[model samples]
Every structure is written in structure tokens, then in C-alpha cells.
Target: MRFSQILRFHLSNNKWTAKQQYVPKHNPVLEEDIKRLQDFLMSKSNIVVLTGAGISTESGIPDYRSEGVGLYARTNHKPIQHMEFVRFANVRQRYWARNFVGWPSFSATEPNHTHHAVARFEREGRIQSVVTQNVDRLHTKAGSKNVIELHGSGYVVKCLSCEYRIDRHEFQDILNSLNPEFRDAPDMIRPDGDVEIPADYVANFRIPPCPECNGHLKPEIVFFGDNVPKSRVEQIAKMIYNSDGLLVLGSSLLVFSGYRMVLQTKDLNLPVAIVNIGETRADHLADLKLSAKCGDVLPKLFNFKK
Candidate 1:
């Protein structure tokens, strides 16, 4: 059954199931598609896996733009822009306050089967490397060693004025000690571990400065209004150039950073396969496209038991 005009094909009866617990709806069409994907992977020697927020959604994080369940569909909350965080003190205060509340759960999230399957592919020499648009370190947690976090990582915090860096866990402790009175529950958690809290909490929150250099502290992430570091782009381009094929998982590819990889793969005349729940920006370029969740398709693709 199609959902509106978007042509979403569900592989399960439920669209929103817990991570690693996806039950196939037993659609024969989906089964055939899975077989095709398996054959496609078997034919390739070195495959590059590109991932985005959909992979993490099964782990209970809400992304920015899904049909009905995304953060934008659910709320009008906008993420902190890069210039806003740099130019305004209040923006940093709000960002840190929300991040402080959401950090515990976000940090504690475990890797799902999709991540494990990708790691398994690497172990078996079926894939060359991974390029991920997610800030969450689930890919690394799942044992994908050659992951390129194209958007940087939320597990790290760095000073803008210097090379000073600290593990995000360590910074959390500093936040705890400085803001003892500003405690509240979060309404929701974004993909990057940010949440919605009271405006007053943001106003009263104390953002800690870098102890080493008195510089501004920010998560090691490429914010919406910021560009991905050029060196990182070159790294991904090189990876794609060396790989034989591209496997896109769970990403809509709306962001140019992720989408351009697909474009590059096509320009190189390499085949591309996409497994996502909705229409992606690079669908026309894909040699094969399956409208299904990553948790459902990845296990079958890797021959992992459901």
C-alpha cells in the first residue's frame, strides 16, 4: 500500500518498531528486491556504504525530515545554525542546555543490527569503507573501523580558537558541576542529541569556557549553516574513487555533502543501490532502489537472522 503520493513501500506492518526488532510484512515484492540487492553486493568487490539519520531512527532518535515521524513534522524546532552559535552568546547557552539534558540517553544508545551488518561486510572484505552523515558514533560502536564521519562527531568537543579537544563525556561532567540548579526533563531528543527545554533554563544556563585557552567550546559537528571541512570532502572523494560500487543506507541525501557522494559515484560510472523508507534526492541515479527500512533490508542483505 502506498502512502500518499510519495510511493513508500513498507516491508513491515509497523513503520516504527524498536531497533533490531523489525518484522517483515512478508511482501513478495520486497523479498524479490532483497534478492536483487544480495546479487548486486555479491558482484561487487569493494563497496562503500553511505549512511544517514534513517539508520539511527530505529535506535529511537528522530531525524529532521521524514514523512510523518521526523522532528520537523512533529515540532517547529529549528537546529542551531553555525553563525548563530558563533555570533550570539544566547544561542550557545540554549544549545548547551538542551545538549546537557539529552546527553545521557544519547550517549547510552547502542548500535543496532544495521550497524553490525555493515561492520560484518567490512570484516568479510565485501566493503572498502564507510561514509556516514550521522554525528552519533554508532558506526564505530558497531565495529566499523574505516568510518568517515563526514559531518564530524557529537562524542567530541573542541575549542574554536585552539587545537584543544576533550571527550564529550568529560565535558558533560563540567556541565554538571556548573549548572546544578538548571535541571529539567527534555520533551524530545534530536538526532544530534539536542532537545527542547524551557527558555528560562537556557537563560540561566552557564556555558563553560575552554579551561586551556578561554576559547568558545562547541561540539565537533558541522552545524547546518557551516560547511563540511574541505579535507573531509576530499577524503570521501578518494574513498569513492577507489571503491567499485556504492550502497546508500537510510539517507534521504537532501544535504549536498551526502548527495554529492552519490553524484560522484554516478560520474565514475559505478552502480549505486539505495535502501531507504522514502524518496531520496538521488533516486534517479540509483541502479537499484528499495523503499524499505535499513533494519529490515540490511539483515537480509547480510544474511543475518531476523
Candidate 2:
């Protein structure tokens, strides 16, 4: 695919789906396949690892599309829409209620073996950079120096109408002060740090406005019905252009934001390797596809201590 074709494809498929199911299955991988993955990394000088929610699942965060234990598999909960979050007061109230209830546990999650091994890969100069769809910031927490958060970070809260910015922790404190009596425990934390709480518990929940401008506040993330910023896309494109290959870690590439990076690599005739638990959208396009957990396989490849 050419640049024009890539752009067209992105435009066509950028819409969000309510639910996508993948069988919770891991295929047997041979020793020779492991060797092939090692050789694949050895053959590339500049490699970019594109990661997704699967990488953080081991850290105890649930992704939306992973097989049985994923959020969609266990619940019929729908993600908050970009427009609704921006336009509706009630939606923002419910969202903040869930976030407030779930933030403590979600923020406490630590980086797992996969994150540490990827950081090791960067330290050893085997990989040049990481482009992750995960907003959890685990890659950076694991000591990866050059990381691009393709979908943005949930740890940041920005004013929708102005230049006010606040750390999520600070915002959490504000939420605590405002809703002192709204103590509700979440059933479970979703991938986006949201949880399921009673509707009545959310009715009186208060969400603060931007202190600097009284503007609407939202997390700095690309929501389900939103597009990734054009500048961010161009930045990743430049990284891929300078790289020898793309190594997808833990991502199924169901979302085009990450999948398009694989497509762009393919268009450049670069080798693409996938290390994931199950099937991926780009399995047919990969030079080698390893159906294994990232935490399990990455430690073996990098010889990192768990």
C-alpha cells in the first residue's frame, strides 16, 4: 500500500466497534519458531515495538478485546463516547464516578516481565523505540527512554476548551474532596481505569471544571469515536520510515491506530513480526507470528529476570 492508499484505508476503517470477540486460545509454538523470532530481531538494526493492552494484561489490567478475561468478554459495558463525554453533564458525572472508584487499583499496577524485557531490548540497542497503544504508561515506567504513547495517556487530564492541564493524581484528590461521601468500591477495573458502580452512586458525583478556565475536563486519550492526532501519526510514520522492521508485542492490531503502523511497514517492504497470545489482524502480513503471551516469550528472548 502506498501512502495515499494507507490514508484512505485509515479513513475508511477508523470507526469503533461495540464488541469484538477473540477465542481465548494459545497455539503451540515450536522451538524452531522461537529461533525464527530471535533471528528476526537479530536481522534488524532499527526495530520499533508496537504494543497494546495485551502487554498490560499480565500487570492485571483488562483489555477490551482479548479473549475470555477481557472486559468485553465478561461484561456488556460500553466505552464512553467522545462526543458524549464532551457534551453531556450526566455522562461526565458517571465517568468520573467510575474512574474515581477504580483509579487507586488501576494506578497501583506495576510493569510486568514483558515491560522489563522490552526496556532491556532498548538498553541493549536491539530496538530503537516503542510505540504503544496502551495509555497506562507501563513502558515508560519500565525505564524505556524513547516511547510514543499513540493513544495518549490516562494519567493526564486536559481542559477541552483551554490550556489548563492537571495530573490525574491531582485530579483524583480533587474528586476525593468533592465527593467525600460517595464511597463505592468497583466490581473490577476496566482497561481505561473505569469501573462499574451503581447508577444512584453517580447521580450526585461532582466533576470539577478546569481551574484555570472553568472548561470541561477530560483525560488526554483518544476515545473510542476519536481519531489520533495527525501530528502523532506523522511522528510514528517517521519512526517507521527510519526503522528496519516493526515488531508488534501483545497487540492484536484490531484498532487501526496501531494496525496502520504495521500496514505502513508492509508498504515499505519491511519485515513485520508479531508476538501475541492469539490471532491478530495482521497475522497474514507478518513475517513471523508467535502465538504466545508477551510476558512469557519476551523474558526468554531477552533473558530478563521476572
- Per-prediction TM-score, please? 0.88, 0.88
* lDDT string, candidate 1, 1-306, tens digits: 223112112213333454323222222337888899999999997999999999988876778887666767667768779999999999898888878887887798778889998998898899999999999999999999999999999999999899999999999999988988754343344333346576777798998888889999999999998999999999899989999999999899999999999999999999999988878999999999998888878887766752
Clashing pairs in 1: none
Clashes per model (N, Cα, C within 3 A): 0, 0
- Candidate 2 lDDT, tens digit per residue, 82-135? 999988999898888887887876687678888999999999999999999999
Consecutive 10-residue window with the lowest summed lDDT within model 2 = 15-24
**Among all windows of ten consecutive residues in candidate 1, which has the lowest summed lDDT?**
2-11
Model 2 gets an lDDT of 0.82
